[model samples]
Target: TPLHLNKVRDPDDQLVLLPHGLLRHHCCYPGCPEFLRDLRTENDLDAADAGKAGDVSESTRRNGLWQHLSPKTWYYARRSDAFLVPRVHRIARGVMDEAQTLHHFVDLTMRKLEEELRGRPAYAEIQEPWLKECVTALYGEYLGIMGV
Candidate 1:
């Protein structure tokens, strides 16, 4: 019989099913697919949102190399995209390889804040204080727990 995965636990007792389609699946990005390679389960509807399934498989690759897949296209033949290239490199280096969706969302938010403040000398002058305030506003004691 095939191995079965039934339950995965998250912070808030969120339950994820197991290997519904494949044991694990990653992005189709050549440099970073599987960046978040979590175990997939049969009843896991999140698989679609996770960028897995009904797309290219390992066998059907372009130029014998892994490529990204979109719903409209398979094997997106190109170098890393400008927007996602940095994230790809980060995941590949295993520097920040945690699979928490909220964490990822927070990271993105912080990046956007920093980007907006870039090149503004006035903003830069108070960057640290402003950042602290923003963090406090959003997360109260959670920032302390996060060592912020």
Candidate 2:
């Protein structure tokens, strides 16, 4: 069976058949292994090209485009899960398993921060380079601790 490029759906149920090599570029993202597997399995070059009936040159090029440019298909053929799982896990680690308490804490903290920043007398006037840098660093540290 020939795998039609436009018919494949990704794990999230989004259609994966992007023209002009977009699929090849974005398949390396954190949660695309299932999509990559489906693409490779359905679009194998030799198998697809063997079934084509007309001009071998054009058929070969069109059929092989995904295979040629896909890093997941070429470089990590046997290790698709290995490539995607760790990154997915890292992202999931920051997400609260249960949302109630985390959401409440976040809401309260944000309100407090907003109040403190807005209450400052020099808040509008403190636009100096050092002050900006200090604010940026403080925000970064807060986010790091919050795992966001």
Candidate 3:
């Protein structure tokens, strides 16, 4: 689910305000393990790829074009969530039995993560439109997995 990227040239990404029902606060426990795991998932294949039947180098290139040209790109396979989610996980471990306690922190962390994503170095440097789609699409997939 790519965001409406053509909506405007607004400096801000077109992140819509969710209806109240779609918010994580409506969940039984915000920041639950399922939500966290979804954030860590790296399984977004493009629709144009015919569910990954496309060229391997395409995915390879999408996975490759990022900061430092390394797997340390934080959202790529084997690299997903490496820098962002672990700290939250560490703190949330103590409150596992009371996962709701994480709602606020989870919310903050997610917003900050989005901010970081939008601010990522060379995140949109690719002149080709389709090749540059991964960052937002994968982020959108995680949001969907989180059921928001």
Model 3, stretches more than 4 Å misplaced? 1-69, 72-100, 121-148
**TM-score for all models, in order of appearance:** 0.20, 0.18, 0.20
Per-residue lDDT of candidate 2, residues 80-137 (tens digit): 2222211222222333233345444344433343444465533432333443333333
Question: Sorted on lDDT, highest at the top, how do the candidates line up?
Answer: 2, 1, 3
Whole-model lDDT per candidate: 0.32, 0.36, 0.32
Best by lDDT: 2
In angstroms, how far off is 72's CA in candidate 3?
A: 5.6
Residue 55, model 2, lDDT: 43
Error of 3 at 128 (Å): 21
lDDT of 1 by residue, 31-127 (tens): 5544334323333334333435554343222221122233313122222221121122222222122424445534654555455546653234223
- lDDT score at residue 91, model 1, on the 0-100 scale: 26
Looking at candidate 2, the ten consecutive residues that score lowest on lDDT are 82-91
Q: For all the candidates, what are their Cα RMSDs to the real structure?
A: 15.0, 18.5, 16.6
lDDT of 3 at 119: 51
**Model with the higher lDDT, candidate 1 or 2:** 2
